[model samples]
Target: MLKIEDLHVAVDGAEILKGLTLEVPAGEVHAIMGPNGSGKSTLSHTIAGRDAYEVLSGGVTLDGDNLLALDPNERAAKGLFLSFQHPIEIPGVQTMNFIRTAMNAQRKARSEEEISAADFLKSIRAKAKLVGLNDAKIKRPFNVGFSGGEKKRMEMLQLVMFEPRFAIMDETDSGLDIDALKMVGDVVNELRDPSRGFLVITHYQRLLDYIKPDAVHVLADGRIVKSGGPELAAELERSGYDQFIEAA
Candidate 1:
């Protein structure tokens, strides 16, 4: 299980996540929904160990391992992955090259054998197909010239290829069409199992239609305002965030 203990995060002396606490057990999916500026992204970034996502207080752990003690790469090596809503564009890095490097780096850290080029190609090709990505698209520079939906698909591709222990997808369906949303759901459900967990953060309930979360959390003003079953998402969809916003 991933235990977040009253995590307080600040960036450049500005507090963002305030005493946020949550738990994501293995084999379950948790969705966090909230309005703009509700500190949702900060929680994801802090958990992923991004630079300058300074830890003001509290702790985060996976199983018994303290996650706040690791660097970003260290966290990745320990099986924590974050899917950005707006994936960055790297002009010079090819998609395959980056994934291979990441895979090898993780293996090297754990003293495991490196994956062969042929095997790497096979694995990526299969995962790309799973994410509805074509060979040519995967050959392009990372996120370069890709649409918003395609960038999200690329994120799913990585999620499937790595099959990390925990994944935080931040607003992954922001610009996805209905078809893309279904594809997102397909990718997530395919990765579901007893050893992995997901923290899905989004502003809309449409994405939840594809990936039915076991629990839904409403985060507002840097704290969880309310939490309930999947029906909570439907309620939010019908009534909107107005009531929750006021409560928060």
Candidate 2:
């Protein structure tokens, strides 16, 4: 449901992503793996329309609509969600309120009715449980005092609640244990519809074991070096990224 064509990007006048391209169609999962500084995160940020990461050239589209032309908020409103590698800690903002506002924002943008408070709680409570989080965790300030794995769990909570048409998860498995990683897989599999797509950017193949991506891409030095099936992820784990790094 997302396409990137010969994408080029920069931030504050420095080049980052150079001629990168990939596609994640509906009902499929794609994993992007690479060493540090290969523009994995930049690709996600640029696709999400994050500020400062200017698209110097090329195009990104969500189901044929120009994604690069939209603002970050607009992209989000279009059912595009990016789960950051590091979730911020908003000490005073209740997690419940934050998610409710975001969900309502998307709904209002689409001319859908705002969820009733009772409905919001009911919906998110079910989603929260799906992500292995309890009601108390959802009641806390967003990510405040949460451990790394907990923050990742919180991100999954949002993913489940939002149920976006397309999601770009950046380093979502960074700190997750096997249980949390499986939670990620469960939520993804549960949301796997013919209208939903996912791009999972990660550094290791362990997460792939849980999600079973439809395709695997090796990104290095700002471009994709190899594209293969699930077997490629396993190959990389056995062979290492050293070859791709050199090729990049």
Candidate 3:
């Protein structure tokens, strides 16, 4: 389970996540909906242990392991993945090489044998197809010269390939079209299992139409102001976040 207990975080001396608390139990997918600057990305980055997102107080734990103490790479080795809202472009790194290196590094940290070249090739090709990415795209530099939708596809490809125990998708639906959104849902649903968990941070209800989160949370002023079943997303869509924002 991923649990947050009164987490207060600051970035560059300004607090973004203030006394936020939430839990994503294993086998569940939870969605977070909030207006801009509500600390949705802040929560994700803090969980992933990014630099300068200082944890002023509170705690975050994954299956009883204190996540606050671990570095970002250590967290990745422990099966935590964060799909960035804006996938950056690496000018010179080959896509396949970078992913393979990262996969092997995580395996090495876990004391597992590295995947052989042939096996890695086969797996990446299969997952690329699954996420609507083609062989040509995968052969290019990572996210370089790719459209926003293509970058999102690359993120989904990694999600499917890594099969992380817990995933925090920060507004992955931001720049995607209907087809790309459905592809994201398809990859997530295929990976859904009794042992994996997802924290999907999104602004729209359409993405939820495909993924169907078990719970929907309303975040305002860096805190979860309201939480409900999947229907809450629709309610938020109809009513908007004004009420929740005021309440918060």
Best-fitting candidate, measured by lDDT?
A: 3
Tens-place lDDT digits, model 1, residues 66-108: 9999888989988999999889899999999998999899888
lDDT of 2 at 146: 93
What ranking emerges by lDDT with the best candidate at the front?
A: 3, 1, 2
Candidates 2 and 3: which is better by lDDT?
A: 3
Which runs in model 3 stand beyond 4 Å of their true positions? none
Cα misplacement distance, residue 107 of candidate 1 (Å): 1.5
**Positional deviation of 171 in candidate 2, in angstroms?**
0.6
Please, what is the TM-score per model? Answer: 0.97, 0.97, 0.99
Q: Provide the global lDDT of candidate 3 against the true structure.
A: 0.94
Listed per candidate, the RMSD to the true structure in angstroms reads: 1.0, 1.0, 0.6
Sort the candidates on TM-score, descending order: 3, 2, 1
Top TM-score model: 3
Question: What tens-digit string does per-residue lDDT give for candidate 2 at 139-225?
Answer: 998989999998998998888888899999999999888999999988888888888999999999999988999999999988888
Give the backbone clash total of model 3. Answer: 0
Please identify which of the two predictions, 1 or 2, would achieve the higher lDDT against the true structure.
1
